[model samples]
Target chain A: MATKKKVTRKNTTTNKAKAKTKTPEETSPAMDNPYISASFWKAMWIICSISVLLEFFIHRHKHFEDLESSVLGNISNWFGFYGMFGLIACSGSILLAKGLSVFLKANEDYYDDTP
Target chain B: MRIITMTLLNNIPPAFLLIIGAFVLLILPARARKVGAIALAFFGVYAVSQLVEGSNVTPEFLGFDLTLLRVDSTSKSFGYIFTLSAFGALIFSWSERCRLQNTAALVYVGSALGVVFAGDMISWYLFWELMAISSTFLILARNNKRSRLAAQRYILVHLGGGLVLLTGILLTIHETGSIDFTKENIYQNTVAKNFILIGILINAAAVPFSSWLPDAYPESTIFGGVILSAYTTKTAVYTLVRGFPGEEILIPIGCIMAVYGIIYALLENDIRRILAYSIINQVGFMICGIGIGTKLAIAGVVASTFCSIIYTSLLWMAAGAVMYRTNKSKCTELGGLYKTMPITMVLVMIGALAVSGAPLTSGFISKTLITAAAEHQNYLWAWLALKVASAGIMLHTGIKFPFFVFFNVDRGLRSKEAPRAMIAGMSLMAFLCIYLGLNPGQLYSIIPNSDILVEQVSFYAIYIKHFDHVATKFQMLLFSGLSFFLFLPMLKRTRTISIDFDWFYRKGAKLLYSGIDKTFNSINRAAEHIVIKTFLPSLVKFIINAPASLTIMLFRPIWEESLSADKTNIKKREQKIISQFSSGTFPVAYSAIFILIFIAILIFLGRSLS
Candidate 1:
């Protein structure tokens, strides 16, 4: 019943900007540069800031202990060891995608308007 | 111990009642069935809280196996809320006559109940799939082409997750070799750990695979949408709590979902679709609590799981009401509905507040705990993000939904409120949300740790006491004040469907599908053209020229005379045969075999899983 053209646009640019603010890909959706979108750079700084805070402050607890017995405990030792590495490696792929976007992106409509 | 045993005993009667309800709804007369379902559902709900005897209560049938029919405080609470979901769903479907819908919803709930109480992975898997299949039937009962397609896609994604889950199960069994489905932080084998995480994340409707929900749900039948709101995803949530609590990724994934849902919903036109996305958002909170992985956080997840069930169903109840009455769900098509359907409007507003995590609603008690848990874990960014998204929830669900659907200018039409049963069904939930929020201590007791009560009870008290806390007293006053101002600009009557993630699939991928379809079709035509017009014609000319060329091929004169007579009759007969075989449709055997082979593939899949 309602038509799209009749619906007034409300600062589409700003609205999209706001939506991007909380998006999960805010830091890096692609890999290469990882800083392609200005918003993503800002989100990264935010993450780095918070993660630094968490590691330094909250993790400063004496609860961390090494288990010398039981098979389950030994198993957790490996996961704690490897899972962190896995996360870091996966994060690299994301960073690279962001960087590579710079080279692949061509002039607007390189397929059509240029010709 | 006695308390656990009694609770286990309490659960058995309801299980029997539901198993019976599942069959009765299929075999009985329609009118008689509705009444029977309601009565059975009521008693089943009552038994959830009444029969609890102890904490480690297991009920075994046919010997020696321990089945924790009633286990810990958390399981009991989930079991109780799931029963509540079952009751509400029964009432919502009271007038819905699709026998398949009723039967499927019944067994779906029972299977989910089984999952919650299951003490083993094998049992959980059985119930997990039962929920998936029965729920798919509910979607298919909508009996539309779109729903049928969505159902197929839905099954594919879930079945994929199921396979991954099976893979995880096998690996875990190989390593730990234990079937006990209790909590385990066994990320010992990285491969098995990631497999389980991926499998779990898929069902949790975390990224890349979240499309099935919003895509399939809105296409479901009238009340089909109701039961779809529960069971499947939450069962996955239950599994995550037991299997992978305190895992860090769930925090980020869940937070992403919380914000993702609101943003996409902000752009969506379909109310049911928006609410479907909101289900992910709510489940996100539960998963986040599990990530925090503490006593308070688990309590938060359990309470929020129940709140999501109640509030999500309530939101759908109102949206489904609008669709049922007007046959329109897009916000652009709906407005000023509050004038005609006051009760629906009021219930919708209440549902909206609960959804926005407004103070003094069920959401407040359940959702606040999750945010607090994140803060306790010192996830400051997540904390800040969740709070902003909380406000965004207000904008998207709380304000935007009600504002556009009801409060926007009149569309020059009138509509009736939902059926009496639907209204009664929603009212029960709206009442509970407030009842639980104001009296959160009542809810806190069911959460496992004793320490939870001491910390949370006081926290809720501060909020409750702030301004004549009569549950709705503070909420109503606060909401009216906020809604009257912040949502003013968004409430303008001018309208359009905001763009969303589905736009990539619904519109963009649709364009891709159609483009690919056309390209293949034309390529097929071009190939046909080359073969039929060129190669086949050349072959025909060659065949005609080869042996039958001229006089030699024409046999001797006398033999030719006899053959000509015979050939003339044969030509006539052949003409008649051609006329008889010609029909303007695919042969019956063609369609039958095509469908049969298609089903054959599904059967193959089922076999392969074993």
Candidate 2:
């Protein structure tokens, strides 16, 4: 290993930056994992409750108009019944993808680019 | 012009032409095969031109019963570009004439042509699968392990998608009793709409299913790469416009694919894979257009489709040319090539900038329509997302591909320019890009309800038309340009694989196989213990002891009584057992029963573990 390092070092014009890429073999205790970060859940809770509030207002409006999609096109199209549902659905899918990414995350060397 | 009315029928001309081309290549000499492919390209071009120039609401083929080959304006425009794509690829491949390559690629191109031209669903499906298989062999003809593996994977994916399509078609037929390819009103049931859309979306490289195109394309042979770029995803766009033009879900799906493809491309190392992802990115704009479902949006779809076909072919040609000259692929290993292969470097740079939507290029004229339509609707979030993605495109593809391959720090390669045939083909495409960009009116004429409306002055004309109101696109172009140069320091050639949708299947399959293997091994060990510890040894002991005891027992009983009772207990048992064996063959049956009892004891022991 030392000999291999010597060979590479001879080729490089400088030896300083090489230490950064010679990564530690095991866990690095200092680096924070984003999946476990407090802010992630905090962000999710805030956005989701906000969405629930928006859904409440939308339903109250839908009760007044009594139309499902309101084909009137501009102002009334703002708070249709489906609009609230669509936003909730979007949030669900986005969070699911985020959850999946965390569960499926691997070490930095996951797949080698060159065979 | 008089519009001709005729019955809905399908033509066998294109299919016959393809088969005949394959047969000629197989039997004829190599030179003849090259001539045959060129002639076929001209034949297709003439037919397509007639369809495009003629003024008609609908057209038909004469042979297949009631199957249509009608020419809607949108379809006619697509057919024109498909033919041109075939011509460009055919011209580029003229230098090499491997028999299977020629046969398969011609059939593949013809099959795509058939799909584009078909007016009904059944005929469209027939050519769709044909395109899949025929193009797969184009990859296989490269005859390397990687290429063969890639070919197999490509076929697997398309065949799987074909199954989904088949189920959808069967259900649709059962439900509607009509297989007409005219714009489908399939939103009657939500579940059925999802089934039909899933099948089409798979082919369009919508996020989860899109990895296959980039995964398979880089491994194809050079000429095969050109044809590979053109067909599959575009067919999905064709089907989308046909089936679900105004469906609301596609807007987000297309938006995701547009941005996802660009980001992955930023991480991509292979030149062709970069182009492949860009194909998805380019198609995203079209998909978004189809979602808009207005006349202007359809016009946007038309222009984007036309531009995508030409630019994609050009980009692939550039990659192929580089691969042909220097066998090295990774951008890190390639540089300083432009100084030697100046023609290649220049044509490729043109292609690169066009993909970036540089002004006075094909991309500039075509991509604006969709983004303009989005802004026209005041879809502020959607518009911002698309604009950011367009700029990202310049970062990933427009600069990375040509910049890395041609202008990177020199790696000492001094290869010559591409073959004359390749250069000529690229020149043809380059000329078309500039010509169309300068006079987009030529292309706009073919678009329904929009003709000769692409004057540069019209960009600032007081009208609210797309060409007039493309200020944001110009901003994207400028900002992307500035960002690329500013972030030049951040750019470096590094080898890395982006974890795409394929990573899920690849890594998940590995874990699944290991789990199943572990379960099977435990079951096998339990069975082995039962057989070894009890069944086999018990059978051996029964055979040996039974024969000896039966024969000796009779004599031992007589001798024991005479010899005296002194040896008593131990001797008595042995004598009795020997006498029993010597007496009869009944001892053998007794021993067999004992063996069966021992085997049952072993089974009890194994069961006791639980």
Candidate 3:
């Protein structure tokens, strides 16, 4: 993926040079030189792992005790329930937005000539 | 001198001080304007702080008692923040050269303070409209065509909302025979209550009427955007908490707005528009808390309003700084800015984290109170939806805003740091975000209904006493961060806008205009053709020939008997007489003779009948 981005950048730069125009892509550095290093990703992963793991040692109170015990016992009480719920909720909202964009998205000038 | 100062402070409303100072600032020389504005704002804050509880300044107007300076816990909380933010915004815009914008900002801030302290519906309505009118100049001060158009639409919508509020106030006054703005008087008239609610909801940017914020705020000047973000909807939220607490309908409306804001922000390209939409989302939490009406929920709403104003303004300041230096506001056009503008990047990240309710930020402390209030009341669905909205906020604003603007693929843009004034202003707000988060007690002690809130469900005690609660929040927020990276590929920025409720007006207004043009204009044209073109000319012709024809008939027998002539000569003589009468050559004698004869015939018929 990184290699493909670099190739695209090179082609765009050549095209921009031929046209003799100052494009943003021409001034921008290659996409391969990422500002966020590999160490940052590792640190983030470790933090996430610890957060999920800490849920096990902590005693959680049941906000919906009766409903949880009767219908789906201990599911919300599980160690990574909060983490799993967060993950699902975030992804689900993104997917929903993607679907919504099909109908709602328009060009930026959609209302410019409205009158 | 000391006694005079004390009397002045005690008797005068703080709003009046700021308003009067605005006019005074306008006359000062250019160089001293900034100092004047800052001093005025600071004095305004001092006056608000010195206000005693209960009504301080009550003046009679047209036989109605007007409470211009009502100091209660709620009003004081809002007054303190409103004036403080005004002071900060004045500092932020210290270098702004537009004199009109400066005066307008002062008046806008003054009117908002007025709304907070007003105790009568008449005074409240007056200040409400004043706020709407003065704030429009902030957008207009951008002085571009787009900003002009946006300001036009902004004022029209606000004025329309003001009319609706006035109608409700009038009806309530008529029904109750009093103009007090208390909750009981408002609830006295059922129809008036709903009208007032709808009017306030429009200002609150509740779902359908919410498009005005995103439509207008992004078009304001950089500093103007910072000030704009703090006041308008929050004032509406203040009114909501004051007037319509425990209205169950607000729960659903707030939930929909919370999710609606996130969905649109996800697809938005403009960085400022994204922030504008998030304003709607944040206000959703406050509105939902008001719907709960629990002492804890009201406390949460007040605390969050204070915190949200600070963090949101900080975010706008950062965005404004970038726009000021680079002259770009699109997320797709901005990137790698973090490399050069590190201070701005850090401040913006702090704001983003605070908005996402990260553990040690203002959002975490205040937002939890609302959700916890929901849970305590056994509102399982509201609790779940709020949790989802919280995570969604993390995705849209917390991660998406900063990443796209500063840390996305480098676009090779380089710029200097924001102005010293802008940086100082943002730092003040950033400090407040963390300070309030770490010490909830400081915020809790100032929020309205704190005594009741502590006795009911103490948010302060919960965080201080329970470690698991903090851990649970961390687990959710951290995992949401994990999900963002996992799905980073799908979160691509596009040069597009998402259609919102404003489309009804932006596009629907055009449709309405054309429809009216097609329907009514055509009818008008047809009427013009019949009346002026066809019917009027013929009527004039008939009127011109009528007297001649009538006279010819009346004189035909007389001419036939009196003249001895051939048929051709008789015909010629009659035609000549008719022409003379039609041309007015016969003078007034002919007309007078005909009129006398007609009247004599009418009199003969009357005598015969008698």
Candidate 4:
């Protein structure tokens, strides 16, 4: 019984040492999370709101006033030309690049033998 | 004393100073060499600026007057960037002990300067080949298998282009009896014009040949990449502006280059390769601007080329710094670097923003000019493509480069900041980025024909008063950031590089060579059977058995051998010859075949002459 108690004490001491050596990041569950924090989401919301609010307050200029105005051009002048066209362009390019990679991406060794 | 001052003021091409300085670098003590190279570069810049506008020199070579130097607005602008690039690169690479690289870089930059000031087709071709050869050494200076192979491919492609360019120059000379390289209606479907365009487009990284830039640039040494990024494509752009401005076909070609770069960059794992593709993308805009052919468009093209040199060099410097510190380039292999390498991260981000045309940066000032010109010319499709490409720039270069390489996953790498020399180099570029952004007038005034525009329109009215423009730009950039994060999962870094068209050359050539070898093997077998089995045996029998005076005199057998022995000897020789006919076994025979062909050519020429 005494020997068993001594082993348990030794185990507990090792556990304490392990805990002491743990990184600050490992100790805190909140910090260890790889996902973006709630604060980031809140900040993003504020940025999005500012984009919308600025468009409403500021007077717009016509781009390419001489040429036949594009249909998308008229729609772009609304509450964000508003953030809509830019967003679509941004997301559209990303998706397009992604689609391209489906056929194009290969292992780094794709040209290994050549160069 | 007056003569000395006159000589300094003489229209001596500044390329002489740099080319001579390259040789001088080898003799100078290591410590002085760096300082000497830098001084030479700055002096070259001064010399270029002092040059007067005219056909400066007509050095006679082989009875042909080659215009060795021409100082004009276009040449001056290009010379400005080329010399400035040498200065920045020398500063960044100060710690590199390889004097050979120093020499190669000097020669590379010197030759590019030569191309800029070259007035005649002959001088242009000379400098063009020199630029290609010298830059190959820069790639080779890395001294690794990958770099060596890349350098080999690089030289082969450049030499091929140089050959095409030479043919075009010769044809032009033959047809027009002039060696001048001035703007002409070269796009009227002439073979010479098409060849010249193809040669220039290869260097510009347009479409199919675009693979070479990304294939080679990433494999360059750290500082070599910075210098490499500045010269080749920009020189091509300068040539295009000089030779083929307003050529309608270029607009579509340029658009393809722009979009293609973005696509390849999005899938690239190596940071340097991404920047390489970005070079194509940026050069594409300039090409498009040149195609538009308006004064504002040309100015925009020049400004963008100039701004790109600064910002792109900064990115290369930053990426080199990261690679120098961590010895890693793949995005997947690098992360949490911002914690240790904050300065590098910050500098890289500044470059990123500049390239993405963030508000109040060099890119915004330059890229907008081109888009505005496109709109003014009513190239709606081109304008729209440019806008989309701008967003794509934001995706791959602006956010992806910094976010993945520095901020994302912490790979537990702790490294010191870039060396002080590199930091100084990057700081200089960053300062220019912001300075030019705030006061584009400094750049605008230098533009050859923008003097009138500069005086009339307040920059504030153009850039700031249009609340819609600024607001829309901001929304695009900021929301692009949003989409990056929202779609971060799909954009995760992977250990892969996208396959490009070089696969056709690298793999397709192998297939071709093998196919030819297989066909040649069968032909060889049939010829061998006829020669060794039938013809040689019958000839030997005739010689031995005819017993003529000629046969007796030639043979004079050393030993009294039986007829059977002689026949056995002939049979053994036939077997030996047949065995030697195995596939690719007789390398000596290949040389013999070539010799025979050469002799045949000589004989044919001799007979024709007689």
DockQ of 2: 0.03
Per-residue lDDT tens digits of candidate 4, residues B45-88?
Answer: 88887787888678898678988788878788888888987898
Q: Model 4 segments beyond 4 Å from truth? A: A1-34, A69-79, B1-7, B185-189, B455-459, B519-610
Per-model DockQ against the true two-chain complex: 0.02, 0.03, 0.38, 0.30
Q: Which of the CAPRI classes, incorrect, acceptable, medium or high, describes model 2?
A: incorrect
| Model 1 per-residue lDDT at B27 | 82
The candidates score, on chain A by TM-score, as follows: 0.27, 0.27, 0.62, 0.62
Interface RMSD of each: 19.1, 14.9, 3.4, 4.0
Candidate 1 chain A lowest-lDDT run of ten: A27-36
Deviation of model 3 at B495, angstroms: 1.3
Lowest lDDT block of 10, candidate 1 chain B = B468-477
Off by over 4 Å in 3: A1-39, A66-78, B1-4, B452-464, B519-610
| DockQ top scorer | 3
For candidate 3, the lDDT comes to 0.86
| Residues B178-211 of candidate 1: C-alpha lDDT, one tens digit per residue | 6566556336566777787788788778866687
Where model 2 places Cα greater than 4 Å from the true spot, the runs are A1-115, B1-16, B52-68, B449-475, B520-610
Docking class of predicted structure 4: acceptable
- How many angstroms is residue B150 displaced in model 3 relative to the true structure, after the best TM-score fit? 0.5
What order do candidates take by TM-score, descending? 3, 4, 2, 1
- DockQ measured for candidate 3: 0.38
Candidate 3, B342-419: lDDT as tens digits = 888899989999999987789988898899888777666677778888888998899889998888777778788888
Question: Comparing to the true complex, what docking class would candidate 1 get?
Answer: incorrect
